[model samples]
Target: MLTVIMASRNGAGWLKETLDAFAALHPPEGGWKLVVVDNGSTDRTSAVVRGFQQRLPLTALHQARPGKNAALNLALEEAEGDLVVFTDDDVLPDPDWLLQLRQAAADFPDTGVFGGRIDPCWPRPPARWITDLVPLGLVYSLTVEREDGPCDPQWIWGPNMMVRSALLEGGHRFDEEVGPDGTMAYRMGSETTFTKELAAQGARCRHVARARVRHMIRPFQMKRSWILGRAFRAGRGYWEPEPERVAILGVPRHILREVGEAAGRWAVARLRGNARERFRAAWDLNFWRGVLHEAWINRARPKRRADASRPGARDRTALSAGPD
Candidate 1:
């Protein structure tokens, strides 16, 4: 059997559409089930899930916790499938999404991770500014457009990725510090966190372009402030750069070069009145700022342990120092 899991918080707005899509899906060879984890939602999220229980093999779980990873980790207790699929409530998946994922799993049984394509579905007409950031894969969770076949597990997006049950069963869990938490400050990279750790343990990943989903781009995400904020957070998720412990002439060469490049880009973009270029420069600048802040934060604090899956040991406030 296969189990599809998702963590939602106040997602009733578009969840009905997603649930309806799941209802219409034709089960694969071994049959499939749905597990919905309500992550501290005040809306009618539970009601929506309960309503769909009659139509789909649904299981509703309530994780009073605030984070997406927390809800997903809670759902692991109820998961009963050899292949576990993960998605989000706002996503509108194709009818054959499960079929394609199952087929890919069958074809690549040894591969530990499977990532599907995520195409954007704008709620309203997107402005030029919003569309411009799509190619960067920074505004949202869209992965490599031209990428397919075997690729790095880091390329996997959370909205449509699957992993072997054995990985989760082996006590590997998503990093609680990262991922959505129904907050404006939510840091991305929950899926990537677990996938990378699994990859280090000799696991491989595959990209299944055939399994596709339409990622909903809400109106809020189009705002300049929101987009820029996401870009900044994404920088923090990209990697936590270490502080320059050694400096020549009391200055770090890399920091100086990065600052100079950022200033140059910002100046050129402003002079040319290029919105895209302006935001691109801002994104890089913010990323470096995040790295600097993280380095300072880490430097001021003592080193912590590395085990992320231990019960009651996960740091609720610690953020994932993204990919290096």
Candidate 2:
């Protein structure tokens, strides 16, 4: 049996499409269940799920906490299948997603966690170069064939991932301190960390190309301002070591280094071809801009320490102390 879980917050607009895609995958044998953890959505997210109850074996779990990992933990407690699959609310799985995942699991029974490919559904010409150059969209989506081996700790993403229930049973859970709620204060390394932990436990993790999902891109995400904002937040999340230590003490050097590195890359790409090089240059520039901007904001803003013993404290402390 397989259990599909999704964590959503005010995702009513997109939940219907996500649920519809999952509903289309109900196996004839009827050994699958869809579980949704609604994280205190003010929108009609619950109502939408209620509507889908008749069409699919949908169960909605509510968590008032505003964290993605918190919601995931709630779903994990309810999931009752040999295999547990996770997808984001803004994503729609490929029609044969479950079938492909089942085949992958069968081919490698030792595999504890598996992540599928995700691609942007909408294309923005203005940012196309940035997308192409950085491959920022989905660098972890590997094209390798089926082979049992240790999973790369850095290649996991939550949108299209599956983990054996045994892994969870063994006391594994996503880090609640980071992810979507952490915003600029903390960036997500949970997927990577979780996959690595599983691999360290002598379990195999693999990437399957067939288990695909299309990530929806909103108009806001395409705008330069929004992109830069996300980039800055991502950099802050990446650079800051602990949530409490994200103060003004270490911003200058970090900003200079990030910007300098980006500028150097852009200069190098300029010597290459126009089509690919320009795109690469744009992406590098944008990435650096985000990093530098984040450092500047970190320096300018007042610091507030919340839950000093949180999971990401080490990273935040490192950022506070000095360069990483």
Candidate 3:
């Protein structure tokens, strides 16, 4: 059996359609259940879920916390299946989504983690800039377009991922501090962190092409400001490079080198008058700026304990929203 879980906050508008998609899913060999966690939604999210109870194997739970991870933790308590799948409220799954996921699980029983493809469903025709940024993962999350096979777990997005229940049973949970906080404060790598930790514990991930979902893209996400802001948050989430990786004369020099490289890219783009190149350069500059911005923010704060001073430790303590 499988259990699908997702968290929502004031997402009633999208919840109804997603529930309709869930109701249309063809049952797997052992069936599946849906667990929707209401993360302090002020809208009609609960009523929407209740309306679906008679049509689907749906269970509604509430987490007063403000973070996506916190709500996911609440759903984990109610999830009851060997294979637990995670998705978002804004996604519409394929009719055979659960069937495909179950088939993959059966075929690759040894692989404990799985990710399916996520294609974009734009509300309107995307702007050229928006389309360009899609490959950068700033426009929409879960952009994996890999062939069916084993892959690095980090590419998996939270919106279309499944993992063995044993991981959660062993006390694994999403980092509360690193994901969406029920608002526009977009943080990156919430699922990536958990996947990296899973890989560290000797688990590999499989790519399931058939178990696909269509991620809804709002028109606002296509704007330059939104993309830039998303890039900034991504920079903060992915800023904690290994000391050995960025050890060229320490943090200061390494950041300088990156900034200089980005400036060169911008210069070349401007000289060539290539719109795509210019946008890419701008994205790189924003990401680097976000990295530096977060660094300054962290530097201003009080230092953490010796153990928490290690690489990636600060990200969890300062950026994460849940208990460490």
Candidate 4:
């Protein structure tokens, strides 16, 4: 049996579409179990899940403590399937998602973790340059066609990943301190840590292109402020362990470089067409904002050596020092 776990927070708008996609993936012999973890959504997210409960074999778990990891852990505790699949509420899986995953796992019995592609479902048509400027998770659509073999482990994107239950029971789970939680501190990297730990434990992890999902890219994300904010936060998460002197000097240095590059592009675009340049400027600015916000928060609450020994210390440090 396959258990699909989705950790959601105020994702009412897109929950139905995701659930519908899952329902479409149901096997004719025996359908998969769907578990939705409602992470303290103020909107009608719970109600939306309730509507789908009758049509599908769904279970809703409520985690009042806010955080994507917290909600994921809650679902993990209750997951009863031999295989566990994780995805986000905003992502719509392909019709053959489960079928492809099952086939991939069967082909490689030793595989512990398998991830698919995620293409952005942009609200409006975006300039081609925007794809280059912003990271669109992994380019699974293009990479999936290669021959099946062991590849170097890259960072994991949350939208589309599947892991076996034995892997979690053997003591691997999502890091609870980070991930998007309504603040500028959008925490990430838990997926990266989880996959690395799986590899370290001698478990095989692979990626199959057949299993794919369309990530709904919101209009708000296209804005210049949001793009820069995301970029800065990502930078802060990457470089959190350095001394204050290093961080203080490094923050503006990177931001200035990005700003200069964006300005140069914008200047060239003035003579040519401005569409690509404008989008690049927007992404760069937003990324810088996220980085600066992360730096400011880090400066405000410097991490003590004692705090570094906690359960989620690395992630906490990353969230505090930078964007996720």
Candidate 5:
């Protein structure tokens, strides 16, 4: 059986729609079960899950701890399937989503990570400022447009992806330091953290293009400030300090210089009265600023440990220097 997991927090309205889509799903060959973890919701989120109990093979869990990773960790205790699929509470999946993911796993028996296609259902057509400045994949968790086959596991984001149960059961857990925590600002890319570690252990990854879902893009995300804030958070998530790079107080010296330069660019863009250039410059400024701050915060943890999965995998920068 494939056990699908979701974490919800005060998103009852959206969850209702997502569950309705779930109700229409075509069950996979091994059958499927749904587990919705209530991540400290004040709304009727629990009631919503209960409403779907009779419609799907559903299990409801409550994790009062705020973060999304924490809630997912709680649900891991109930995982009992070949694949532990992860998704958000604000998505409408295709009818054959489970069947498609199951087929991908069956077709690629060795691949431990599977990514599904995520299309955005925007609230409305976005303005040019957004279209020109914001990236769908960065903020919205949309995957490669329509490509299939082998791809980088990092591209497989949290909105829709599946992993083999053995890894989690083997004691792998999500890093609570990262991922959503019901805050105005937080790091993204929880699943990518786990998947990369599993990949380091020599587990192959794949893109299951047929398994698709439409991630609902709320109106709040359209605001420039929110997008800029996300850019900073994205950089924070992307941070991986090169051990050999010169540093002081854990932050690379080069980063300080780059941030200063970005500030100069930001000033110049503002002077030029170019909306696009100003936004681009501001985006880079925010990204580098985030990287600089994270670098300083991770100062003591200078380098990553060698990949323990293989005898001699190449050393590379890691997302969270903290343990999984």
Candidate 6:
């Protein structure tokens, strides 16, 4: 058996559709169960999940903690089965999603991490301006074309990811700071940091092209402000400060210079460039601003990675949504 786990907060509108899609999934051998953690949602999220109880071998858990990573870490505690699949509540899995993943896991017993394909489906086609400015596939966790073989663990997006349950049960955890909290503003690349650390520690990784999910790109996410904000969050999420590099106000000199250069280019583009060119430049500018913001915030604080910072995280039996 395998466990499919995800977290949702006030996402009831999409949760129904995601569960409906799960109902259509073709069960893999040895069976599977779903574990969804409600991260303090005030909406009908619990009701929606309960409706799918008969359809899936469902286990509902609740984490009052604010962040997505915090919720996911809770699910990790209750998840059974040898393979643990991680996905989002806003995605539609293909019928063979779990089947392919299980087959891949069986074939590659050496691989500790597995990333599946994610295809983004929007309510309506986006305009050329935004399309040209954003890397749709990269930004939306869409398709990353490549052969089914060994790949970087960092390439695994949260929407379609899997790993050995034993690995997580062995104390590997999601860093609460990197994922979505109960807010409009937050950092991106929620799981990449965890995977990067896993790879560095010698966990073999693979990309299974057949296991797929379609991530719904919400309308609000298509807005310009959201896109710009994502650039900033990605900037903060993606930055890796050089330990040996000298810094002023916690930001390295080269990064500060890059910020200046980005601003100048954006100004020039705004004055003379076309719509796409201008937005692209603005995107770069927002990215550097995010990088600078993260650098400044962490400059004075001692560096430490801890999941216990999430409220009540030390309690193993606190999941409020009941057992499987």
C-alpha lDDT values of all predictions: 0.73, 0.64, 0.74, 0.65, 0.79, 0.77
Summarize candidate 4's per-residue lDDT along 1-324 as a digit string, tens digits.
888888888889888888887777746224578889999999999999999987877999999888878898888877876788888888777888888887887888988888776666779997565566555442111232434455434433567778888888866776666555656656445555566667667777677777878877678766656655655555444434335344444353554565567667667776777766666665555545544555556654555222332222233222221112
Give the CA lDDT, 0 to 100, for residue 270 in model 3.
Answer: 95
- TM-scores for all candidates? 0.85, 0.73, 0.84, 0.77, 0.91, 0.90
lDDT of 5 by residue, 114-217 (tens): 88998888899989877666666776777748588886667677778899987676799887877788875576556767777788777788888889999998
Residue 105, model 3: Cα distance from true site in angstroms: 0.9
What shift in Å separates residue 278 of candidate 1 from its native position after superposition?
2.5
In terms of lDDT, the poorest run of 10 residues in model 2 is 315-324
The list of candidate 6 runs beyond 4 A from truth reads 302-324
The residue-level lDDT of candidate 4 at 189 comes to: 56
Ranking of predictions according to TM-score: 5, 6, 1, 3, 4, 2
Show the lowest summed lDDT stretch of 10 residues, model 3: 315-324
The pairs that clash in candidate 6 are none
**Sort order, lDDT high to low:** 5, 6, 3, 1, 4, 2
Q: Is candidate 2 or candidate 4 better by lDDT?
A: 4
The candidate that wins on lDDT is 5
- lDDT, candidate 5, equals 0.79
Model 4, stretches more than 4 Å misplaced? 28-31, 138-149, 243-324
Using lDDT as the yardstick, the better of models 2 and 6 is 6
- Most accurate candidate by TM-score: 5
| Candidate 5 Cα misplacement greater than 4 A, ranges | 300-324
Error of 5 at 147 (Å): 1.2
TM-score, candidate number 2: 0.73
Candidate 3 matches the true fold with a TM-score of 0.84
lDDT (10s digit) by residue, model 3, range 56-126: 98889998889888999889888887989999888899999989998898899899999898887779988
| Candidate 1: residue 168 lDDT (0-100) | 78
Query: What is the C-alpha lDDT profile of model 1 across 163-235, one tens digit per residue?
Result: 9898877788887887677676555567767777788788898989989888887888777777656655654
